[model samples]
Target: MPVPWPSGSICEAGVEQGIASKSRLVDVVLDESIGRSTPDVEHERAVAIFDLIEENRFCPVGDEGGGPYRLRLSLAESRLVFQVSREDGAAVVTHILSLTPFRRIVKDYFLICESYYQAIRSATPSQIEAIDMGRRGLHNEGSQTLMDRLAGKVEVDFDTARRLFTLICVLHWRG
Candidate 1:
């Protein structure tokens, strides 16, 4: 028999003790504290949020929180804050990660991204592809780092971590 969920709780498949069935973020909001972003940054943010909402796997580790979740990403006091909440607007978990670990990778990723964007304008196809490859590599590294940092705090797939990393970069841009 299916377990009865409390009012405003979301129930998914396989809702056993520590497992929350497949989950995704239904709404993602960037904190206004980051200030306005450039058009390029804004576009990237939009795409990441869209892709994450369209497909993702996220569950709070060791918590009975259900999905879909509402997430707010922001930088506060030099830390990256992931404010997660239930669909009904009740808070679930708030994970504040240190930015020090991400500093170098994020810096490199931005540098490569700048090069990639510039390459798109004047570089040869081969050159552009090379820069793009580097950009992707850095992106992947950042995502992996994120997953590692979130380990035991929250559980997410690689693709979901990648998208979240992008948003983190966006936040880092202004910080």
Candidate 2:
């Protein structure tokens, strides 16, 4: 199931629009409505990528002032980012932020996700299972072992792995 957002944590009117006619087009607006997110095109695509991992029992990602964040997916030519942290016995939904827009500064976000997926797809079932387990428990020893095993095999840095691991902790460690 999707994580339940905290009450009064939704920022509906705080959504900002990019300056008109800039070199980059960050046109999407994110707002809260009825306890769910109401994001524009760019944001919605990122959310969909986030949902992919969430549905698969992985940490749901979010964005937060460019701090250590999580990557939901790089699917369909887009990259979805989110802020992940733990608080109050539950995974805090801090902010759903984006990187340089997918099609704006870099248009190959989803392609990167696809590439990662394809590369991992060639692993054995046991390896795949291990990765799934690693994704779910990035903060634990077992997950660390799993990730370490797949480190050079996959295209992820320790920093990325660490962030993704923290994200899993915050996502699953909840009230």
Candidate 3:
């Protein structure tokens, strides 16, 4: 189930402080409106969420509330939405980013991922390693794009953005 978001100010204080209270995410939810994925993709999604929950640093800019935030990721219309809230589920912030910049990277990542998976089955060790390297490169590119998009809206480390990117790719899977 998705975390419920209440309508109100994102923070109790009007100032942008407490960004250093070790702000992080304790839970995450993907909107049910997003299409379902294949079994492999579902497994990847679960692992990413697990990894994210295990370790992540997420601080929303200008949020005075010291938090372990609960995040709800969803796609609305053509935009990706980041709905953040306090651990108690009070609305903290909502950031919406365009999918335009991610189109090419995501497409290429999908292609590389397919190749990597295929290589794992029959290709030689060297071939699989090569494909896997390319996949990791594309993954890095996508993660960097995500960080850039969320720059001022939310503060996150490379690893956190990478895991979030993985979830975003899951949401994009067609099969």
Candidate 4:
């Protein structure tokens, strides 16, 4: 099935051209952090992120980690917050982004993506068929606004960003 933008193709392309893509990074980290509780909690966090994405493609958008700054991820139409920072020698993603009343950029964009994602995932067999019918149908439609919102929300290091985007594409294309 056709996947969403910035999914597999974008990530693959990004890797070739040196861009920040999500899927690539997630795979590397998860591969490195699979079984044991190693010295790098960041790698573990990456695995957890993969788990979360697999379980639910939608998450709230907000300051998930809480401190002066906010770290977050966008899936579907929701923004998942992460208590992230570059310290020691790894990138840390802590906490799931929550639903807050405030209108933060990360959160808002995530919500949009989450909405589209939910609509796609919740589609029945008939609905899926309908969406697949034509270019303007659900499957063929694209969300530029969502993509615009997604801009900069994925600011993790190169590898992590690529991996995350890759996973997002997988979720979007899941049948």
Q: What C-alpha lDDT values do all the predictions have?
A: 0.78, 0.31, 0.80, 0.35
Worst 10 residues of 2 by lDDT: 19-28
lDDT of 4 by residue, 1-175 (tens): 2132344432334435543222222222222112234445445455556654332212112323222222344332343334343323244455443323223433443445455556587878776555445322221122222333344443222233333433333322212
What are the per-residue Cα lDDT tens digits for candidate 1 across 141-170?
Answer: 999999899887877778888888887887
Candidate 1 TM-score to native: 0.81
> In candidate 3, what are the lDDT values of residues 1-175, reduced to their tens digit?
2211112424313213444334679999888866667888788788889988887767787876568899998888889989999999999989999989898999999998888888888999999999888889999999999988987788776788888898888778776
The all-Cα superposition gives candidate 1 an RMSD in Å to the true structure of 6.5
Which is better, 1 or 2, measured by lDDT? 1
- In angstroms, give how far residue 163 of model 2 lies from its true place: 15
Rank by lDDT (best first): 3, 1, 4, 2
Clashes of each: 0, 9, 0, 29
Report the CA-based lDDT of candidate 4 relative to the real structure.
Answer: 0.35
RMSD of each: 6.5, 17.0, 7.1, 13.1
TM-score-sorted candidate list, best first:
3, 1, 4, 2
* Colliding residue pairs in candidate 1: none
TM-score of each: 0.81, 0.21, 0.83, 0.25
Q: In model 2, how large is the Cα lDDT of residue 155? A: 24
Per-residue error (Å), model 2, residue 98: 15
lDDT of 2: 0.31
